[model samples]
Target: MDTSRLLRTTGTVLAAAGLLLSGCTTSGSAQRASASAGGATGSGAAHAAPAVPEEPSAALRPYYAQKLRWRECGVPGFECATMKAPLDYAHPSSGQDVELAVARKKATGPGKRLGSLVVNPGGPGGSGIGYLQAYAGIGYPAQVRARYDMVSIDPRGVARSSPVECLTGPRMDAYTQVDQTPDDAAEQAKLVEAFKEFAAGCQERSRRVLPHVSTVEAARDLDLLRGVLGDEKLTYVGASYGTLLGATYADLFPGRAGRLVLDGAMDPTRSAIDLNRDQTAGFETAFRSFARDCAKQAECPLGRGNTDQVAQRLRDFFRTLDAKPVPTGEPARPLGEALATTGVIAALYDESAWPQLREAITQAMDGDGAGLLSLADSYYEREPDGSYANLMYANAAVNCLDQPPAFTGPAAVTAAVPSFEKASPVFGAGFAWASLNCAYWPAKATGTAHRLEAKGAPPIVVVGTTRDPATPYKWAQGLAGQLDSGVLLTYDGDGHTAYGRGSDCIDTAINRYLLEGTTPAAGKKC
Candidate 1:
């Protein structure tokens, strides 16, 4: 579990690989793999396939006290809602409602409304409603926007929806600064204490909400939203951890699935350990890409050389920081391994951030760590005023409830060190050990990893970026393979999710699917 650790590890590996491959121009073969055909034809072809529903569940009641008053928020014609779900689905009649923030932008065209289009921007902890209001609600292709009402809901225990808050502002500051790559017994003990403190904080501050934030419950909440939205079936687009949420929905309500798109998919079958190690490898892959690109640039920090050597140099730099943090202008300005690692992971979310990461690295190399530190802060969603978002707290709560921790003790982490380092020579060791944080989670896991067949579901499009850092490409491959009606769309390039990261081919394909109800061909790459 520990989805944050999983995401962080995944991001690190993909970032490392991306850094290494930055110098090499994408091959024609790669381009072929990345481009896929799009349009209403694909959607029609997919819908013609047989329906499959592996699991069926009862519908959820509307939790709103009064009908929503639809009004504009940020985007033109967008309306927002504040719905409610049970703190625990199994105990829905318990009278305890967890608020779920939602947003909608109605169709804008001459055609009859096809249905509601639900969207989620990963994080297991990311604010779906916020993302909808900020980007997807307005930025999604106009064709898709014209046919369907765009909708988003913040999952339980996430932002603006009865969020799970753990540490206070100052406590969180200390938690973020805790050294992640411990070099000595003292440091290791400190790390363990940090985990304990974090868990304890959640138990103390958000006890009633912590145990019920599992992905399964959130998936159930999605189905409830589907019912309330008056859609006969669910049409959704979820990215990163959002992919996991979508897949879970399919598993739980396969009969209701319709035109689901899971981008940057997460593999539900993988154990916490497997997820962590694989992610380590992914970051190494990304680092190599970045390193290769950096080698050819004038501001290259690791210099022109083999990617492996450059990775080692970066590792060495991390070690140096672990020993003596670098100054960054704040009260506790020096950057430690945790903050540095967070900064590195943030850039892995998008290829467009590669140049900024390079500049951050160059500055850090020259004893100026502010830029990189700032990137880390942004990734952590830490505010400039020293306040913090509830993201990390919610992330930990949900992840802890999804799966058991990979390691229970520092000794186990120590034992796994070599494997972690070998998985990703650049980021393996740190990420491998970071997986242990959830070992001390106050609440026990309430769910287990399982395949999402969605046998009776309509054809679902699963998109994956070959070098996606957060949710590895293999996850998309695995999820598509798992779903009975799944169709795979591959993007043979670097980034987190494919739809809006700047590939016209990708945007076109997804747009065509949403607008026309088509599905991209299996193995189609974009």
Candidate 2:
């Protein structure tokens, strides 16, 4: 997902680990019924693939040998560090370098330490250090926290790590509500201009960093971090987009993978177009689940009706908002269809937020859109003061650099709309158009879709929440099947990620693996 156009993840609080199909309009039928909350079981057939060379080149030896300078920062008990990595690995000899912000909470051990266990809560744009300090530092199971040092690094071009900057607060505000679901040529033209301006602003403000934030570079940075931490191998727990980062690292440094757990996994072999469509379908699946549950309630916003009826009603509401946006308390902003849709999608990540969504929708239906607007604001990381974080900027920078655009222009999107709508009727058109955001990206993509068969790696667990909205369960299944040593752990449940959010079955398996290096049984369902 293009984090820039698609608002994903809250900054410090790792509340929900799900994907939001942003910058798209709401218009999709149920792609699939709600998936079972059970682990996947099938043939463990590995695809024919070459092994990734584990060793780093001699020219880059200095970077791998560099030591981190750590100092106490943020919450007590967590120490922060900084390291410098080559801005471009292809030109390691170049003088250019990018700073990485890292944080660790040393193991509170009574037993032998299990080395550093790095954690990332997706959003290629999410602040790893922020996640470490706010959640993992204190919220991880006590046993896991006591045995292993919890570590994180804000990848290049993310928060506090030489971030990518695009539009200012006011400009970004206007950009979010651009007629994403264009009804005519003029609206489409305006949408294209918005993408162009966003791309141009990123290039203008963050020219140097934009091109270097690809997942490949970020994964390489992880290997460097592993070396500096004095860990011969990398131990990691990554969710959502973080799974892509973890898989890339495992592919790049197979021998270095030490009990990596990729929750909410993405299929490395899939193209950007397929990924967006699959994700669109996932959201539709999730929304249907939400709609079905909503219909059972007396205060249901879409009213007590079947899934299709509820979905159609919501679509109708979106069209109504598109025609005449509801007044949000904020003077400059109105509850337009795009933002309102984002607000609703944000809640679909975790079932815990369903009640909030119900309330927000009820409020929106009642002529007050403040609740829904607040939800949208949270999705965008827009502060009450109106300032925006570097999340969106960095999201685009990394996503665009990681792969070629899914669609090159409005024409291509128009051509692909039918397939997208087929995958997700309500969300298809908007997401099909949203896929074009990267078409106008300033930097060329440095990576391509490929299978990660980390042939020499230790057991690497790939977790999937069957009903995951951002990364569908099938992605996890696909990734596990592709990796040479991947094991599947399924959490047949509601929400984006399975670990830590609440699942003793899932948590126990992960904890045992992280602490004792015990691989969960293949096809383990929680």
Candidate 3:
């Protein structure tokens, strides 16, 4: 999913993850629905296939051998560090470099200290350091934390690094509220302008680092990180879009790849259009699951009826909102179809948030859009002062760089609508239009839709939630199948990711893989 048009997550915050999707709209994140609670933000894939050599050339040897300067930062138990990476790996002699921010929580002793366990909670744009401090550092199982140091890095062009800045908060607010499911040319034009403005803002404010923020480069940084940490290989756990980063790293540095767990994986073989369409279907699948559970409850705000009927009614409500927006307590921000839909998509990242969704829907239906509006704010990671995090800006930068635009223009979106709707009746059109944001991107793509074989890597465990709203389960299957040593661990469950969401089976399998290096038997189902 293009993080610009599609807001998404890692298995989210046990509150913090998941993104929003809208056509031509500068949508906010779809982050990691953390196996515990987070969603992957952007989706990534490469095509044809780039030739990746096993080792860096001698010019880059200095980077691979550079040391990190660690210091105590604001976070309590966490120490921060900075590492220098070539601004352009292909041109090491350019005399320019990017300084990456990193964080770590040293392992709690008792057992012999294992190597660093680096984690990424997706967002192609997500702040890995934020996630490490917010959850992974303290929230992970104690047994695992006792031996391995919890570490993370804010990828280039993301938070704390040289970030990609686009619109101001007020402008973003207007952009997010733009009618995404356009009804006519005028509406479509409004959407198009929003995307154009967003793309222009990126080029104007962040042209320097924007072109260099591809997943392939970020993966290379991981190898540099591995060397700096003094680890023989990279020990890692990545969720949502993080999986794509991890997969890319494994494919590029198969020899340096250590124990890796890619939860809620993305299939690198799909084209950009296919990825957007797949995620539309993924969100629809999750909505059906939510509807089924809602049907059994008397408090269901969507009323009774089957999933299709309820989905139709929900569509009707959105149309109603399209005609008239509702109040959200904040005078400037109202609950319109775009925000309401984003709110719904955000909740779908995790089933635990269903009750909140139900209540929010009920409130919206009652004309008080506050509940749903709050959900949208959370999805966008909007702070109280109306300032925004750099998540959305970096999301578009990385996503557009990873693959060519999914749709080139409004005409292309119109042509693809039927195929997209065939994949998802509820979200097809919006997502198809959403896929167009990249068409306005300033940078040329450095990657394409291709396979990630990681031929010489050790066993890499891939986890999939049966009803993930952002990354479909089929992607997990596809990724595991492509890798020479990929093992698929299936969790017949809800939410965006499979680990840390109270599944002892999923957690145990991953824990063993990271700890004792025990790879679960192929096709293990939890």
For lDDT, the strongest prediction is: 3
Per-residue lDDT of candidate 1, residues 1-526 (tens digit):
1124434212212223321111000001111111111001111111112222333323233452235656666666778877777775545556888878889988888688899999877666677776776677777777788888989988888888888988888888788888777779998999899889989999998988887777767776787788778788899988777777787777657778888888877777777777777777777777777788878888778778889777778888888887877888886657877788778777765666778888888888788888788777766667778887777887878777677677889999999989988878777777866788889998876444556676777888898888876667887788789888989899889766777766888888887788777777767886
Model 2 alpha-carbon drift over 4 Å, by segment:
1-55
Candidate of highest TM-score: 3
Q: Compared with the true structure, what per-residue lDDT tens digits does model 2 show for residues 200-316?
A: 999999998887777767777888899889998899988788887788777667778888998888887777788888888888888988998999999898989899999999988
Write down the RMSD of all candidates, one decimal each: 8.9, 7.3, 5.8
Instruction: Determine which window of 10 residues in candidate 2 has minimal summed lDDT.
Output: 27-36
TM-score of each: 0.88, 0.92, 0.92
Question: What's the lDDT for residue 188 in model 2?
Answer: 93
lDDT (Cα, 0-100) at 65 in candidate 3: 82
lDDT of each: 0.71, 0.77, 0.79
Model 1 TM-score (2 dp): 0.88
Order of quality (lDDT): 3, 2, 1
